[model samples]
Target: MSKVDVYDVHLVETVASTTDVKPLPLATIDIRVPLPDELIHLSLEEQDSLERHIVRKMDRRLMPIIIVMFWLNILDRNSIANAKIAGLPKDLNMNNAQYNTCLLIFYVGYVITQLPSNAILPMVRPSIYIPLVTCAWGLMSMAQGFLHDFQSIMVVRFFIGVLEGPFFPGVIFLLSCWYKKEELIKRIAFLYAGNILSSCFGGLIAAGIIGGMEGVAGYAAWRWLFIIEGLVTVAVGILAMFLFPDYPRTTRWLTKEEGLFAEWRLSNEVAGIIDEDSSGIWWGVSEALRDPLTYLFTFMQMMLTTGQSFTYFLPSIIKTLGYNNTITLLLTAPPYAVAFLGSVALAYSSSKRKEFCMHICFPLTISVIGNILAMIVHGTGARYFAIFLMAFGVYVVYNVNYAWVSSSIPRPQAKRAASLAIINLMSGGATHFYTSYLFPDNDAPRYYMGGSALTVAVFLCAMTAITIRFYLARLNKKIDAAGGDAEAALRANKGHTETMKAFRYQLHWWTWPLPKALGTEVISIYHTSSKSADAAKIGKSNFIATSTEKWAEKHSRTLETILCTFFKNGTQLEEYILMLDVGGIMVYVEIPESALPPLPPGLITGNNFAPRESNTASKKEVLQMFKLKTDQKIKSWVEEVPMENCIEAVEKL
Candidate 1:
């Protein structure tokens, strides 16, 4: 399934008199030609309406399913924290230190399969893939209820981590596949808020089951906690198998027109090439590995996830407020509930404002302040307020950064998938190996040791995000300089597509009215240097440059033509007021104010001798400026052309 994009030019012309040349209308320049058969006949406004309807339909069908799946993911992964307070430690004869080991083991198993699973996801149906793994996760989590010893529970937790490993990155990759970067952040927020919402409810669910279901059917309430949550997860997985949407190209629910538009719209974003089909799995892995951003994101995510170490111990931290198990679990819900609301609001802000770094850093700052205050403040009320600050802050940091990673490296779908997997593996799995120890028993009440280390990590997380923001901005500046696609832009020196990108291909076709003296007569001659240059070399080109100012200096009929250039909206010669002495007639060209374009070998390779811009630069400076010389001619100029210029340099009679 490969798509090759070829272009057709649709142009409009405005007649200009010898007195004035009006700029071409904007409709004359848009040339993403050969719109698909489904959309080609529609008016631009009608096409826009259809695109909106299709995207709205996609969001309606996909978002809820995505949210629920993540909710279950969070529910199954974090329920153990609630179980800790439900007396599972006493039954299994495990201490707080050993419980941390259980948490560490899950990550150990979780990291093992991530890279491999992500590689396979593109080839599989996500509707089938996500649910299948989820079902396995539920089975392992359910087994935790029957475990009797620390060793056995460790095995179950490890597998739970393994089964859940691919999910977060997989979902992000899935969403990125269907939507452009601008359209994706808010959706990611909903997905992330699902997990935060799960945390809020997991506590309440634990309180009810552990409080009322104690000794139910000869099982402890902690045992029932695992059983019930796992069962609900399994049920949710089955439902997803039916309702979950696949990739845009594969989703059966879309109309044929909608499906084509879905794929076409995404292709338009990445220069008419579909990302999923651009490269193979191993190639994508190589791209991800070679990129330095991957490692930076890994380090930053590791720090952020480490800051979130609090979530694993929040139940214990809450219990220190002199409350019973049920009340403590109930108390944990409000902070997370507040966090859920904040995460969604922050996501909306990030998407609407099109910002990521500050959105991430602000919440992390709040969490850092909360951690510092929790350590210094001694009273119950002061500590609880601190919890409120931290709860919302850390969750937003997590939600916002995920969208940042996806948007920053969106080309060649494989590269994005592998990079996400690697970042999550190191940040989510490897870091937890030590971060799990952040909340040991001796650090209870204040947990100063864990709190301080995590505060530093959270602070570093913010700093790293700030650094990444500047770094990505630098990358963007380069892309802008190269035109658009960084690698493809390298060919800008010679290729048609690349050249068009270099000048952004926006141009006006104004009929150049000849001067009155040339209306009824003709003149012709060739410079000695132009013996090799001819009309064949010029071909049918989009731009023409002319100057007649040199006619005044030439006595009779020495210079044949001063300058003749053909190009689209691009580079230029030196002064806008250039002229050529063609035999006895004068030829003048009006180049738009833009960066100068490269002159053909038939014309002189001279733009340096004349003053670049004059008279307000008069829409002439932004175009490529050119200079004329009789002795040396070039096929094309060596310098790269920026998109701002669209004036040509030419002379003939």
Candidate 2:
């Protein structure tokens, strides 16, 4: 018979004989059927090729739409800043502080909606939720064009903030659902590149509208900017509802085999904990609140975001060089364009090296230098150079920091969603509430006070990132000491993703101990055997007995000496036989003779073995007697061995 037919008969016979016996629990049964060679034994090159294919497919389908959505998201949210330079504040009869209030009020709605929006994301279809919110915000943004006074603009801005609040955090959470941690940084940087590019392109678009559309429709150029951008945003939002893939497991675009492979890859990478169900927003919030790193990183993000708030007033900052509105708007694009390239390079390095802290710290340090230079330098050329440095530094830090948050909190999707939203919400508040006051109109043309505060914030951000790095290092050390068992780390982390035995936080630098601290090797064994032998000649019970006897024979000398020596001294010796199946091949493993406990008298040893006292009336009677004794011994061993340890051993097989 063919090997497949023989195994099929064995399985059927085993099940039929056990029909009247109590069924084992599903977890206790080894039900994995053999797979075809093509599925089970793929070459490394084949695996890599498949991975590349999946990545390319995902990138082609997902990235462009996501990037464009983010571009529209940023353009709508920050267009007010561009409009201000085009005489928006003057046209609306708004003063400097009122304009800042408008900025600050938007964040009030922004902060209020973040937690709920993120919490609701997993419960609703993202394709529907995200696009609906995008469309709502687009309408609100368009309403800005019709507003004639400060209060009306503030109302529209606030509603726009409320509707737009979910997009950033929602997208971050969505990306995490599809990509592994190692793949996340570059993807996030690419998504963030959209934000940077919008600053560049938003400027060009705003300038074009302001220059050409000023008198064409009898509406102010600033009004045309809102109407045109808002219409574009609404259209994209409508399109994205159809384009966006929801999640890897649920996405219909992939074939069945591809979907299973994708899920398996992710589950293995995450140690098999892929929590898709919502565990409740409050539960997620509670978990995040308990993690002290959440507070530290959130505050760090807030400070970093607060310091980089100059992007909102880039036109105003450039205008300090005494350029006209058109020239100033055009000039704003170059710094952000430069920063986009810098951000991509930094993100690539971070992803390649699998590091986070250094990527963040290095950039923030450069930003600190830029802030100081802007404060000390008087020349326009020197100041513009300073702007380039500041823009590159702050934005790269922003992109990588969010990636860090996602990697650091990878499980129990609810908590991850909560943590991301909370950090973003607070950062938004900081951006508008604190950073707004930093750049008062009175401090224009060299806002020394603003620069100094930003300098201090950037320095604190660096210090905080370093501190967080050290804290994770300490946790890693504890994990290493526990023999790299994630359970120990989980105990220490109170069941957070930080305890995921396989998860490691990226450090600022590669240290000698970091690799050992981050991960440990798990040794595995596999055994293969031919299955063409006749079942009667090589029966399961006889094979097990023969294997056990052969193993005992190999260690006979040590076993006999130990048992004999112990028995002579009026003591007993105990030995154990551990049975395991590796790769469908049965193995009988014995404890080392030296480590065995005292054995009982008359136990068989290779050097001194004798048949047990028995009277055989018939061959059947003697055979039955041998079987009963062997069964009893096996039963005793099963009763003594810990079930948990047995389960663990089986899992290793």
Candidate 3:
């Protein structure tokens, strides 16, 4: 009655010789059907995308506070060097040799407790821990003003060194936890710049305090410098208790959503970038110990810190140039000022470029050149240029090197913590022997002992930089190879969950996901039950268009292209799908009655699916859908299970 129209397509043939029409079977068993997209795992190109999603939201406020705190801390600790030039040695009655012993004793107490103190950091809040240490050191520094004899100076200095040892390493660890690995070097350099600025700040403070040579309440100007600066440090330390945030997860300053977001971002960033096998507390220590570069870093730090010991007496060294005490203190500012500006410039560029080795090496070479000039030059102007070079060269590498420490060991927070402690211990201990003897008032104008040692240290440090560069290059190559291997492995055992777990345990934490080459997916497979296996590898790729190299490449690949190409070539999407995670639910794509059968449900006819940019409604929708699907599957699966099988279901899930 209604034309009896057929909606289905059929192959028809007209009989040439007969009026009888044969009705052929409408469906054929041999008919080919496209596999349902539902049955086929739908993966997302999320390596770089996820990275950006996490990195974009990092809080920048902590950076300024941390930088300022460390800046003032270093300034106060090293200012004693400047005070000596303003006649602290004369007022304390410290002789040329007794003064050397005083410097030496400081390291004794400093070196012994470094490791122990660092171990205790996680147990106490940094806000409380750092400020308490600051208060203790402030008191010690204040007490330094009261020392009238060599023994008193020696005792006070030793205690000062002991308390100060934990501060730098503690700060480094805290920074590492908050920033992504790629973002860390620059931030670390910024914080370390405080050490550079301290040089200038110390000179300025000394110039103001000791310039007039007036006694404070019967105390010498040198004594007044310690008391006043110490009191200021104590007050700031108390304030920091209120200002400093706890760990990223517990920061009360941020909204609850913000805190969770921060943790999630870091987790995503670090997922494939680190060794899955190398997490937990013990793993950090083992990883740090196993890496030969850690010791090399130690050596680099030793050489650097040995040269830095000379920083304290720079004003005294300048005074030997025939300037009165006040002029010497004033003159100290220019070279140190040059250092602060130069280091910030170099550090900013170096971090921005993500080039650690060359940037650091350049400064070490410059430092060597500076020291050589200081020793060889006869003219006063040339010698002063040498000092400027010395200050600038040292500061440039100082921040870069600390960044190196944080970046090198990507786990068990303990390794980062321990290595930092070791660096400080070696630095402080080395200072005990090297810094005191070089600047004897006897050597005054030309500190041959000090100059020679600094020169040697600079040369050694340059060599150390070369070694580190070679090692990182090799390590980077290994990491690249591992990425390929990881992808291939993922493809070989698709749909298998246990294999993913094994893979996770075998890989390193900071190694990011492999690219679309050698069988790894260019897109991450959602709902695959193996996410945790590769979660440790998350931050392994370039996440931010602002920071990473592969951001554009990741963005250009569409979902349709990825699936069509993967199916056509059968090469497997090994690189992109870092892991498939099994969770509380699974998606079951539904097929409408009018849609094609034989093909599984939810098969799109067109190849038009594309990768979505981060923060898009599409991406958010996908995540939400996946979550809903997960919950639905879990509920259905549980509902079907018998009560007797409940334990088995829980175990399987």
- lDDT (C-alpha) at residue 490 in model 2: 57
In terms of lDDT, model 1 sits at 0.68
Query: Residue-wise lDDT of candidate 2 within 1-653, one digit each (tens)?
Result: 01100100111011000111221111000112222334455433344466667778888988889999999999998899889998899999999999988988888888888989998888888878898898889999998988899989989988888998899989998888777777788899999999999988988888888888886668899999999999999999999888888777677777655655565556555555565645677888888877777888898898888778897888899999899888888898998898898899988888765677888888888899999998889999999999988888888767888888887776778888888888888886545777877788899888888899989989999899988888877765555446445567757767354335444455532212111111211111111112212222222111111213344344323211010101111112222111211111111121222443544454434223322221112323333444665686532111334776988766765
The lDDT, on a scale of 0 to 1, for candidate 2 is 0.68
Model 1, residue 218: what's the lDDT?
98
lDDT of 1 by residue, 1-653 (tens): 00001111212111111211221111112224245876766654455677888879878888888888889888999999999998989999998889989999999999998988898888888999899999999999899999999999998998899899988889888888888766787888888888888988989999999899998899999999999889988998999899888878679888877887788876665545565554678877887787767888899999988888899899999999899999999999999888888888888877655677788888999999999988899999999999988777788767778877876665566877899999989998999999889888788899998889888999999999888876655544444455344555434322112112312211111221122112211122222112123221212121222223343234222222222211124222322223332221112232443555655543332312222211222112212121221134323222334445423321210
lDDT of 3: 0.58
Sorted by lDDT, highest first, which candidate order results?
Answer: 1, 2, 3
TM-score of each: 0.72, 0.72, 0.67
lDDT of 3 by residue, 1-653 (tens): 00001111111110001001211111100111332233223123332343345445444557776777777677767767777766777877877787667767777877877777776666568878888888888888899888787778888888988887777778888777777565776787778777777767777777888865467588788888888888888887888788777666677676554555455444444332321223445445554555576688889888888777677678777766778877887787788678777777876776554566677778878888888888888788888999988877877778777776676654446666766777767765755576667777777677788888988987788788888777655444333334324234433433111111101211111222212211223333322223323322332111112123443245432222111111212222232221112111111121222322232222222222223211112222333444665677632111357889989978986
Q: What is candidate 1's CA lDDT for residue 257?
A: 77
lDDT of 3 at 281: 51
* Over 4 Å off, model 2: 1-49, 493-499, 508-653
* Candidate 2: pairs in clash: 572-598, 572-599, 573-598, 573-599, 574-597, 574-598, 574-599
